[model samples]
Target: MAQQQRATETKEALINAAAVVFGRQGYRATTLRDITREAAVTQGALYFHFDSKQELAEEIIRRQHTMSSGAGASFLASTESGLSSIVRLSGELAAQVLTQPVVRAGLRLSTESADDLAGAAAAPYRDWIGACRILLERAAAVGETREGLDLDAAAELVISSFTGAQFVSAALTGSEDLLERLERMWPVLLEGFVRDPDHPVLSSTSDLIYQSADRVA
Candidate 1:
C-alpha cells in the first residue's frame, strides 16, 4: 500500500512540475530534464510514468478540458438563467486561469502546440463552444436574450471574446488582471444580447467577478 501511494505521489508531482515549466517556458523550449529537475525526481522515475514530453503535455491538456468542462456542466445544471450562468462561468474560468497553474499551462500548451498536438489540442475550445451554445439556447428559452438572436453566433462571440481577453491579459499582466478584464468585458458584450441591460442579474456582473476572485483569495 505504501509503495503504491508513493508512486502515485511521484506521478502527481511530475505532472505539476511539468505544468509549471510548460506554462512559463512553452513546450518547444522545455525538456524532460527540466521537468524531472523541477519535480525533484530522477529521469528513471519520470520514464516510469511518462514516455515523453508530449505525453505529459497531453495529460495536462486532458486535465484542463476536464476542469473547464466540469465547471460548464455545473452551471448548466443550475437554476440560474443561462445568461447569468454564462457571466458567472466566464468569471470562474478567468479565476482558474489567474490562479491555477495547470489551467494556465494547459491553455498555453494547447495554443503553443496546436500544430504539434494536431486535433487533440482543440478539444477544449470545441467543448467550450458547445457548452456556450447550450447555455444560449437555455437563455433564449427563458427570454434572457433578445428575440431572434442567433444562438450559434452568440456562442462563438462569447467564446472568442473570452479567448481574446484572456490571451491579452496573459501577455500584458501574466493573467494577474484577468478577472478585472473579464469584469469589464462582460457588461458591454451583454448589452447587445440581453433583453434588458438593467436586469438584476446583468447588473450584478461586477459582483460575480469579485465573488470568483474571492474564492481563490
Candidate 2:
C-alpha cells in the first residue's frame, strides 16, 4: 500500500510539473528531459510511467478532458435553466483554464500540433460541443432559447467564440483576465441565445456581469 501510494504521488508530481513546463513552452520545443527536470524526477522514473514525450502529452490531454467534461456533465444538469447553467459552467471552466496547468497545457498543445496527437487534442472540443448541444436542447425545450436555432451550430459558435476570447485574453494579460473576458462574453452570448432579448434572467445576469467588472476596475 505504501509503495503504491508513493508511486501515485510521484506520478502526480511528474504530471503537474510537466504541465507547467509544457504550458510555458509548447510541445515542439519541450523535451522529456525538461519534464523530468521540472518534475524533479529521475529519467528512469519518468520512463517507467511514460515511454515517450508524445505519450505524456496525450495523457495530459486525456486527463484534462476527463476532468473538465466531468465537471460540465455534473453541473449542466443541476440547474433548471439550461442557458444559465451553460453560462455558469463557462465561468467555472474559465477558472479552471486559468488555474490548472494541466488543462492549460493540454489545450495549448491541442492548438499547436507538436506531433500526431491531433485526436487527443480534438477530443475535448468535440465533447464540449456535444455538451453544449445537450444544454441548448434543454433550454429550447423550456422555450427560453431562440426558436429555429440550430443547436449544433449554436454550440460550435459558442465554443469558437470562447476560444478566441480566451486566446486574446491570454495574449494580453497572461491569462489573469479570463474571468473578466468570460463575463463580458456572457452578455453577447445571452443576447444571441435567448428567445426574448428583454428576458429578466438576461438582465439579472448582465447586471451581475457588469458589477463584477466594476469591482475589478
Candidate 3:
C-alpha cells in the first residue's frame, strides 16, 4: 500500500514539474533530464513512469485537457441562460489559462510545436468550437442571439478570439494578464452575440452565474 501511494505521489510530482518546465521552456526546448532534475527524481524513476519526453508531454496534455474539459462541462450543464453560459465559459477558460500551469502548458504544447509528436499532439480549437456550439445553440433557442444566425461561424470566432488573445498575451506578458484581457474581450463578444446590445440579458464580463471564479476566468 505504501509503495503504491508513494508511486502515485512521485508520478504526480514528476508531472507537475514537467508542466512547469514545459510551460516555461515549451516542448521543443524542454528535455527529460530537465524534467527529472526539476522533479528531483532519478532518471530510472522517470523511465519507470514515462518512456520518453514526448510521452511525458502527452501525459501533461491529457491531464490538462481533462481538467479543462471538466470546467467546460460544468458550465454547459449548470447555466440557465445560453448567452450567460457562453460568457461564463470564456471567463472560466481564461481563468484556467491564467492560473493553471498544467492547462497553460498543455495548451501551448498542443498548439505550438509538434513535429516530434506529430498527430499525437492535440490542437484544441475543434473541441472548443464544439463546446461553444452547444452554448450557441442554447442561446439561440433562448432568443439570446439573432434567429437563423450562423452558429458554427460564431463558435469558430469565439474559439479563435480566445486562442488569439492567449497567444498574444503569452507572447507579451507570459500570460499573467490573461484574465484581464479576457475581461476586455467579453464586452466585444457580448456585443456580437446578444439579441439586444442595449438591453441584453447579461454583461460580457459580468460575474459568472456558476461558482467558477471571482471574475472573468
Candidate 4:
C-alpha cells in the first residue's frame, strides 16, 4: 500500500513536470531526461511509470483534459442557465490559462504537435464539446438558451471561440489579458445567445472588466 501511494505520487509529479517542460519546449523538443529531471526522479523511475516520451505526453494530455472537464463541471454546477454557465466556465478557463503553467504547457504542446498528439488532444476536446452540447440542450429546454438555436452548433461555436481567444491572448498579451478580455466579452456574447429576455445584462465591457480586474488587483 505504501509503495502504491509513493508510485502514484511519483507518477503525478512526473506528469506535472512533463507538462511544464513540454509546454515550454514543445513535444519534439522535450526529452524524457528533461521530464525526469523536472520531476526529480530517476530515468528508471520515469520509465517504470511511462515506457516512453510519447506515452508520457499522452498521459499529460489525458490529465489536462480531465482537469479541464472537472473545472467545467464545477463552473456549470454554480449557474442555473446554460449560456451563463458557459460564460462563467469560460472565465474560469481563462483564469486557468493564466495561472496554471501545466495547463498552458499542455495547450501549447498539444497544438504544436497536433499531428503526433492528435489522438490524445482531439478526444478530450470532442468530449468537452459533447458535454457542452448536452448542457446547451438542457438549458434550451429550461428556457435558458434561445429557442431554435442549434445546440450542437452553438456549443461548438462557444468552445471554438473561447479556445481561439485563449490561444491568441496567451500568445500575445499573456493569460491576465486573456481573462480580462473574456470577462469583457462574456456578457456581450451572452446577450445574443441567451433566451432569457429578463436576464440582467451588464451594459458595458468596462463593468465586467473592471470587476474582474479589481479582483485580480
Best candidate according to TM-score = 1
Stretches of candidate 3 above 4 Å error? 118-120, 201-206, 209-211, 215-217
Using TM-score as the measure, what is the rank order of every candidate, best first? 1, 3, 2, 4
What's the TM-score of each model vs. the native?
Answer: 0.94, 0.88, 0.89, 0.80
**Pairs with backbone N, CA or C atoms under 3 Å apart (clashes), candidate 2:** none
lDDT of 2 by residue, 28-127 (tens): 8899899999989999999888899888988988888886787687757676678876776676666678778888888777777735687788878888
Residues 64-164, candidate 4: write the lDDT tens digits. Answer: 77767887776456545565556556655555666676677777766678888788878877877887886787678778777788877877877777777
lDDT score at residue 53, model 3, on the 0-100 scale: 88
Residue 183's lDDT in candidate 4 = 64
In the order shown, what is each candidate's alpha-carbon RMSD?
1.5, 3.4, 2.4, 3.5
Q: Model 4, poorest ten-residue lDDT window?
A: 208-217
Q: What is the TM-score (0 to 1) of candidate 3?
A: 0.89
Score residue 129 of candidate 3 by CA lDDT: 87
Model 3 Cα RMSD, Å?
Answer: 2.4
C-alpha positional error of residue 164 in candidate 4 after TM-score superposition, expressed in Å:
0.7
> Candidates ranked by lDDT, best first?
1, 2, 3, 4
Higher-TM-score candidate of 3 and 4: 3
Model 3 Cα lDDT, one tens digit per residue, 66-126: 8878878877897567777776776777778777889989888877866765554644556
- Runs of candidate 2 with Cα error greater than 4 angstroms are 206-217
What lDDT is obtained when candidate 4 is compared to the true structure? 0.72
